[model samples]
Each structure stands twice: as C-alpha cells, then as structure tokens.
Target: MIRPSGRTDSRLLWPIAIHPFTGTVEVVFQHLKRSPPLDDEPLRRELMTKLNEIEGVDLAEAKLDLRPSFPVEVFAEHSEEICAVPEWFAHTVALAEARRMPDGDPGTY
Candidate 1:
C-alpha cells in the first residue's frame, strides 16, 4: 500500500515458499514469479536429506522453482534512487500515477 508520504511498502512475506506434489521427492514446487525467493538448492537438499534421515518420508514428486529475488527495500533506504527496481509494484504504480488520466475520461483499464 502506498502511504500518505507517497512511498509504498514493498516487503515480502518470506524468503521462500515450498509446495508439494505427488510421488516421492520431486525436488521442489513451482512458484509464481512474484513469490518471495529462498533460492537455496543445496540448503534445501541438505534439509531434505536430513528430513528423510529423520522421518523416512519420500519427496520425489516435488517440483521446485528455486529463484532469488532482490527487493527494492534493500536499497530503498541506502540510495537516492526511490525505486531501484523498475518492475517493482511501487515503481510501476508511481509511473502509472505520473501518467494519470484526466477526470471523466474513462481511459483504458
């Protein structure tokens, strides 16, 4: 949400999200492009291996989209650049507002 000061909050819920599928151990689950990223395959493997050793559960049917995302919040406070990430929602919202339509025009939605 954009605040009264015109800055938008850009925090993600978590670093990563896990999904499970059918079968034994399918590695990982597919995530949307906008999801927060953990991006740790080796760590996941280690944890999964440990989990298997500890619980003896099969996890072969998983499909992982291990990815890393660099949020603008990391640099929001450090640099003069307000929105470092051009594609970020905050940045895009700002751009849209900048090009705002005139009142009673019913511009393309």
Candidate 2:
C-alpha cells in the first residue's frame, strides 16, 4: 500500500494497488463528501508512463483501472500526516532494485 501527498483537502485520499500476477494496477480516489467534477486521467497517465519506463516491464502489457468513491465525512479534525509517499515512487525504487538482481527477476521478491 502507498499513500501520496499533495491533497490539500482533508477529505481527499488516493490509494493504489498493483497486482503482480496480471500486471494490472488499480487506483482509487476517495472523496469524503463530494467527488471531483473532473476525471483523474492526467494523473493516471503520468503514473502509467513512469511505471512503463521501468526496465523489464512492458507498458503495453500493463493494465490500469481507476475507481472513484465517496464516503461520509465524520472526522472533526484533519491530520497533516494523513498523506504518505506516493506508490509510484516506491514502485520505481523496487523496480530499480529488481533490475540490480542477477537475472532481473522481479518475481524473486
């Protein structure tokens, strides 16, 4: 699981999951009370591009899915630490480490 920073609104959250078997990635955008009026296609595209740039991974073979959700807002206060490092950044690091392996086998992990 990865948490990304940059959400100013306390009600907004983004979570991403990557499936190793099918190479499919799911991105979820959670809004507490309201949903964004616009689609998050640009952000998703940027993430896809970055992931595809990793060695040993074919972007063409990777599938990306976006999901949006709205949940009731119950919190009285917001925390600054709610957002964490973006998943893509960690994925890139992992990919780099995998490439350093003898056979570049990501499955070894």
TM-score of 1: 0.25
Q: How far out, in Å, is residue 25 in model 2?
A: 6.3
List the lowest-lDDT window of 10 residues for candidate 2: 70-79
Best by TM-score: 2
Q: Give the per-residue lDDT digits (tens) of candidate 1, residues 1-109.
A: 3344433223432223333332222223233222212223553444344333322333341433443222333333433332232234334333434454345232222
In model 2, which residue pairs have backbone atoms overlapping below 3 Å?
Answer: none
Residue 32, model 1: lDDT of: 26
> After TM-score superposition, what is the CA distance of residue 106 in candidate 1 from its true location, in Å?
42
Q: List TM-score per model, in order.
A: 0.25, 0.29
Candidate 1 Cα errors over 4 Å, as ranges: 1-29, 32-37, 61-109
In model 1, the Cα lDDT at residue 20 comes to: 30
Where does candidate 2 stray beyond 4 Å? Answer: 1-12, 18-38, 59-109
